[model samples]
Target: MPDPGSPLARLGVSIQHLLPQRALTALAHRISTARAGWIRRPLIAGFRRLYEVDLDEAVVPASGFDSFDSFFTRALKPDARPPASVGTGLLCPCDGTLSQAGPIFEEPSGGRIVQAKGRDYSLAELLADEKAAEAFTGGRFATVYLAPYDYHRVHVPCDATLRTEIRVPGRLFSVSDATSRHIDRLFARNERMVALFDTAHGPMAVVMVAAMLVAGIETVWDAGLRLRPGRDVARIDFDPTVRLSAGAELGRFHWGSTVIVVTGRDAPDWVDGLVPGRRMRLGEALTGPRAPGRAEN
Candidate 1:
């Protein structure tokens, strides 16, 4: 929970219930995508200073960026985040603080993932696809939260072929831990892009959840997601040839957001020592083989 004494906490409450989220997000998109020097340069510099972003790890220096969007989704140096030695079942998808991680629980309607202490949201609501949600029943889920200072690009956690991408449009709410405790079904209520992948272990789903002031979400294949209020969920099927190796670039958020990774029932168990609030780097080990005598899902 956020300190009630903090101004940001109060602002979050106001924005969640009172602000026109879509309009604000669209305005942010325009400003972030602008290439004009006067508009973009200062914003980039200001953000860098405010967040204390480390430019040394970036592929290009901050001065070389033409737009705030480019800097926000900048690539890292080749050696900056090399994948952990092979044979680890999964890898961390992005640099962020681990919000929560554990096994999914089955329910009468579907499986449920923890959103925060004492709060859980249904898998069907989170994915917006009932049949697709079933694949993750009794599986494992990890939610990582990216702050403004973290790298916003998300990568593939393991070798997998892209199967489907589902775009679900909803409110652009703040996903900070403070808000998560106060807002019910926060992730399910936000506009998100769900990408399903088929791996040697089984199926995996990477859900990129959008938050307040987040301009857009993009994939290596699709330019950007189209999110409009009142629009029905949109899903795209990928070609079987579309494949990505572990640690390869998968997608990115135009601004900081959250990534929730869910694996199928047959997926490997999470490595020991995982705890909420642990900071993670891209390409680090996330899972290992199941333990002996473990009950099957």
Candidate 2:
């Protein structure tokens, strides 16, 4: 467990608990969307230097972006992150630290992924849809945390057809590692976009969780999320024609945050050596061979 007494951890908790979350997030959104070169350029440069972002892989040159959001969610060179072999089962959806990865238990409703060493959040609250949560009741979940320097775009972990999309609005809490260790129901309490897909492995859900300072979450299909701070869950049914192959771009965070992937009980087992704090790139293998009796959808 992380030490809550540490200065950094203590400061994180203060920000999460004491700060005006929505106002701060709105300010961040304004700064991120600002087209003024004076504001965006230095902000981009400072962030790149601070986080050591690799501008070489970015599709647009650093000097080419008109807004911080453009550079923050920059596209990578096509070959930057390639897909794994077809039969490898599941692939990681983004570049980030694998904060938590394991089974989803049923008793409490949220599957068994840990938010921190000792803290856990329910999937039902995360998804805000009991029926959607049920599909992953006895399944698996992986939470990947993206830092400011990481690629903000997310991808499909497997070939799948979009089934449902849910926008669950909530408070925007800072999702830093320290906050995860100290804040209870951190992920569930934060605003998130849950997209359910019907894949060969079964029903898989890619949850885009918003963190403090994050402007918004956008998907390829819907550029405007229109997430209100206190609205009830907004559900969207997708046509079967909406499909994406493994490694295809799914969505992106305006600023870095976290993504949670949940799969049904029949999904493939995670590969050995995959553990908490492991840094993974997009398209890396996440699962091993399929378990007996588990059939592809």
Q: Which one wins on TM-score?
A: 1
In candidate 1, stretches whose alpha carbon ends up further than 4 angstroms from where it belongs are: 1-11, 86-88, 225-230, 289-297
- lDDT score, residue 288, model 1? 70
What's the residue-level lDDT of 30 in candidate 2? 91
Error of 1 at 234 (Å): 0.6
lDDT of each: 0.87, 0.85
TM-score of each: 0.92, 0.91
- Among all windows of 10 consecutive residues in model 2, the one with the lowest summed lDDT is 223-232
Leading candidate by lDDT = 1
Q: What TM-score does candidate 2 reach? A: 0.91
Tens-place lDDT digits, model 2, residues 1-297: 446558877776876677788899899899889999899989998998888989888889988998999999999999999787858398999999998888886674345557877788778788888777887767888899999899999999988999998888887887877788878889998899999899988899999999888988889888554644347778889764588988889999989899999999888888766678899999999998655775532
The C-alpha stretches of model 2 lying farther than 4 A from their native spots are: 1-8, 86-88, 108-110, 225-230, 289-297
